[model samples]
Target chain A: MRLMSKPHSARELTGLLKAPTGIVGFDDVTLGGLPAGRPTLICGAAGCGKTLFGITFLVNGATLCDEPGVFMTFEERPEDLEANFRSLGYDLNGLAAAGKLIVDHVRVERSEIEEAGEYDLEGLFVRLGFAVDRIGAKRVVLDTIESLFAGFTDQAILRAELRRLFGWLKERGLTAVITGERGEGQLTRHGLEEYVSDCVILLDNRVEDQIATRRLRVVKYRGSSHGTNEFPFLIDEDGISVLPITAPRRNLAVCNEIVSSGIPGLDAMIRNGGFYRGSTILVSGVSGTGKTTMASHFVNAACLRGERCTFFSFEESAEEICRNARSVGLDLHAHVAAGLLRFEWARPSLYGLEMHLARMQRDIETFKPAVVVIDAISAFRGPAGDVQSILLRTVDLLKSSGITAMFTSLRSGASRDEGTDHGLSSIMDSWIKLVDVEENGERNRILYLIKSRGTSHSNQLREFRMTDRGIELIDAYIGPEGVLTGTARITQEARDRAAADQRERESNRRQRQFARRREAVRRQIEELEAALQAEEDEEAMLLGEDELRDATLKSDQAARAIRRRAAE
Target chain B: MTSDAERLDEGAQEAGEDAGHYYLRLYVAGHTTKSTLALNNLKRVCETHLAGRYEIEVIDLRENPQLAAGDQILAIPTLVRRLPQPLKRIIGDLSNTEKVLVGLDIRPKVACP
Candidate 1:
């Protein structure tokens, strides 16, 4: 009957009334939050952030939701709890002073306490009721209520009392969070799960390969659809934040506008002149392959356009990156000074991949950058599956926010395949593979445009050179010897030039020899014509003398004929 | 037994007036059966061992539940010995006399060599 009852608000569609926890990415995973006005059990081992989770929930409820909450810590003193939460910037004392929160430390010291006869925990109920009623609290947190087991010897009485207490809390219509220590095989050491069955969240901190990652999972949410995946959460100075990688889907606003890739040559390789405005570009290469330099160029171009950019560097410090960028003729420090560029650097080993993503997401949210550059995603070295999954989520977050992102991955060895070691090339809108072309006993960098979605790009590998001026993408020489780079290309080009010069010189010599012979033949023909003219003149003279008289030739012929006829 | 108790009281009084005096506070939720039993047992023990040398302060949490926080009370029928240098707390109805005497440090002082 209870299961059949509709516990949701009348205005909302069929489901329980949810309470938004105001934690980053937590609400999306829980479909909203824990079941409202109901008890949710949070079980975890020691040092797994069970207490912090409860405190954060209560604090968020009081501060953000405007709902007063009561935090009854069974293990920590009120002052100690306040001191611990202060590191997260949570002013518990201030909230308590404002009457928005009530922290009641239920100290049960077994050493000083002696059990003489039968008893019940009515005093606890009275104190809790008083605190709750004083602040009109809508949320209650019983942190590690299992500590009561250490104080009481009568397990039966404690169980009965706890069941009654849960019922009383439910009747009061208060949202409650009960934390318990992890058991050997059960959800909680004392089986608190049997009492608070409406919702259950499990917090875990696991260390693998010497890297610890905190994860939160909603094991069950009665009457609600929730994300069953183990969401990675981070507890930093700001507080606990869960990364709901599965919630942000691929349906993001696609922009047609393109942004330059900083290097003019690199931009020219893409058909659109640049990458799409909100696209994810993966630049994979081995060590010292000019990946970071290319990313610097991109960030510089974005900053030059007066657009904000965030550069997350996991391998190097901001100063080191800025200094390195300066070597490539990019003044990133100036952009940083101009407030157009922000460099965030952290060691990948300091946190798990998901934490880095969550921090990056938060940075993007606060800075509202138009472009983001992750200098080397490979610095987050771990299982390929985890690295790729986090990268996919990071890309999704950037795409959903309509921010252009460039991720540089470090490929191991000389693998020239299109696939990145992290297997993140598929989700990328554009993938640029950088490799070392070892030729002529020297290594040179070459960049290939592996794929660019929705845009045509040059498939040819360009000799990626980090010139003093900037990056230069020269068209690689595709000779019979395959692709040539470095000094090998230069030597081949010089040899071709010398051979062309020799061919031109031979043709010039042949042309000169032919012109000289033709001139000699023309002179000979002219001399012969002169001689023939002289001979003809002489003949004419002789004829004219013989027939004077024969009246100068042809006239002489007519005159001769007339004379002949007269003589006959 | 009366003479021995008087001599022990004189020796405790010589040290300080508060030394021989017992300040006991019982925290309970109204006049429940366990609360009453605990109160009666505590009074009987005090009268027999520390008659006229003890003071009992009964705190009915139902009348003023806010007072429970001061003593860090959680269980019903709780007795707190406030006057001793190191305070002690005994929970549950004070029906077990031997355990109560040991918990309140009354039997050890009487049995001292």
Candidate 2:
């Protein structure tokens, strides 16, 4: 019961009760959603999804928030509404069967009945009152009540009755959603906007440059402060979702957690181990510039760190992305199989940019992934002006949620977008631009970091090569013709090798000459020492013979002297 | 489902209630000055030429707004002739008696230019 119970007041209460619509990010913009138990008027032009938004509110009230709802439609048939909402997972029929919801279609045909005298709208009141009592609904939705005005000719009576109906709903204290058709000058065709003094929401469907976008704006909210900006909304299978353009960017909680950019070399280029956690990474390049490859590295790294990652590929299918990543040694398929990585692929040409954003937010909220990758945002075709809003909301949502996001964009030319016009390049915490440089009759991918906020990044244009072994980053060989890559890089390397070989050969020849000179000098010294030794030996022999002759003479003299002394 | 708050008083059912072969229906939005003026002007024209021969039905558009589509009443204070083999729709307050007479074909004299 607690699981399905209405969420307690998450924001500070100021004596106003707020009912959350459960629409994506709507409560954030509305401050706390619609004023609780008060009739809120939703008006829009045709095909603006006014009725669908009302239905989503009622369905969410009945299903998620455990508030039984009553859906009284004047425009669409009950069967048609049920069938249309089935795609959104709202089982209107089942809810009606379970006595949790009431779906009543008011059908008043002119030919079938006649009036003769004065009367009031007692019959309709009875029908609506009966349905409300039957379902015990706390939330009510009167979808497109303005259609009843077209049937009635007396504006005075219809306006009076509409005001009475709103007052009665408020008296009942039921959260009611009243949808109306937009008029030229007035908010509603019947001028029934008087009753919407509590809250008024306007939905607009605009088409510019062949792209259709649905925007929701809160024209007025009496009791609470609400977003005044036009928020882009999307209608998908789940239902209507509004993307609030202003995502509490200023007060967003920042962390010191460092996350990898997937490439070790690029990580080294950044100040931290990689990028700041929950930072937005913009990877832009021309076609086949390995933008997706770099994105894959980021995803692969996140998965390696045991963090959940979701990759949204607009141009490639899951299978194609898997196969392509495999070619570059990124095992994304295994990560997907392990449930650490999620892949969502959609063709950008098929859906509006708002729907893509809603689907992306839905995926993020459900997957609760730590990292999200949007590959190739340039392919998203829309009004060049409107694309900025979509991109801003996307980045803002991810950033506020503390989810690190990597967005890859394809460039039409050699220059990179500074994101000034597109609102993308400006808010990014880091930007890595991949460019394809033609060298030696081949295109080589070059990775360059244009900017990294709060981090010191390498300014070198790293030579990035994708091979079966994996993507390898090598120090660029700057030759006389500038930084080289591919075969030209190899050629520069070979030329450097030949130059080193020549220097080594020259040094070896000089050493050999020195060794030969030393050998010749040693032979000369040996011949001189032999001549000097021969001269010294001859002198020593002569001196020794002279000494011997002297010694013999002295001995004979001594003998003669001794014989004379003995005779005396 | 269609029972309450509707009074369908047909000439055949209400006998002797302004006995006439012609059936007239006047549609008005509540009791406004325009609606009262149109009703008074229409009765004066009908009584003059079709006294006790026509049955007039006053239908309040505010009571049964759905009935407007049946008679194709675009503007309030409209007079519709349902009988005499031809359908005629006249709109406005019916202030000009001669014009109303000519419009209803009450007399050829009033109808002539």
Q: What does fnat come to for each candidate? A: 0.89, 0.00
Model 1: clashing residue pairs? Answer: A547-A550, A550-A556, A553-A556
Q: Give the CA lDDT, 0 to 100, for residue A155 in model 1.
A: 93
- In the range A1-568, model 1's lDDT, one tens digit per residue, is 2332344433234757887888888898987888888888998888999888888898899888999999998889988988999999999999999999999988888899999999999999999999999999999999888999998889999999999898888889899999998898999998998888788999898888888889888988877888998988888887888877656756776799999999999889999999999999999888889888899999999999999999999888899888988887888989999999998888999887777887898888879999999978878878878888887788778888999999998877756565554777888889988889775689998888988999998989999788788999899888787778888888888887898899999999999999999999999999999999999999999987897754566786788899999999
Candidate with the greatest TM-score versus the true structure: 1
Looking at the true structure's interface, with contacts defined as alpha carbon pairs within 8 Å between chains A and B, what fraction does model 1 recover? 0.89
Residue A64's lDDT within candidate 1 is 89
Residues forming the 10-long window of minimal summed lDDT in candidate 2 chain A: A1-10
lDDT (CA) for every model shown? Answer: 0.87, 0.78
lDDT (Cα, tens digit) per residue for candidate 2, span A1-568: 1121123222323567888899887888898778887888899889999888888887788878888888888767889988888888889999889888888777544432332222345345555666677678889898877766656555676677777788788778899899888888988876657766678999998875566768889998765788898887878776777876554566777888999887777888877768999899899888888888888989999999999999999998889888998998888989999999999898886667877887788788889999999987887887777688778878888987899999998877745544443668778988888888875678888888988899888899988888886678887887687888888888879989999999999999999999999999998999999999999999999999999999999998999899999999
Best by DockQ: 1
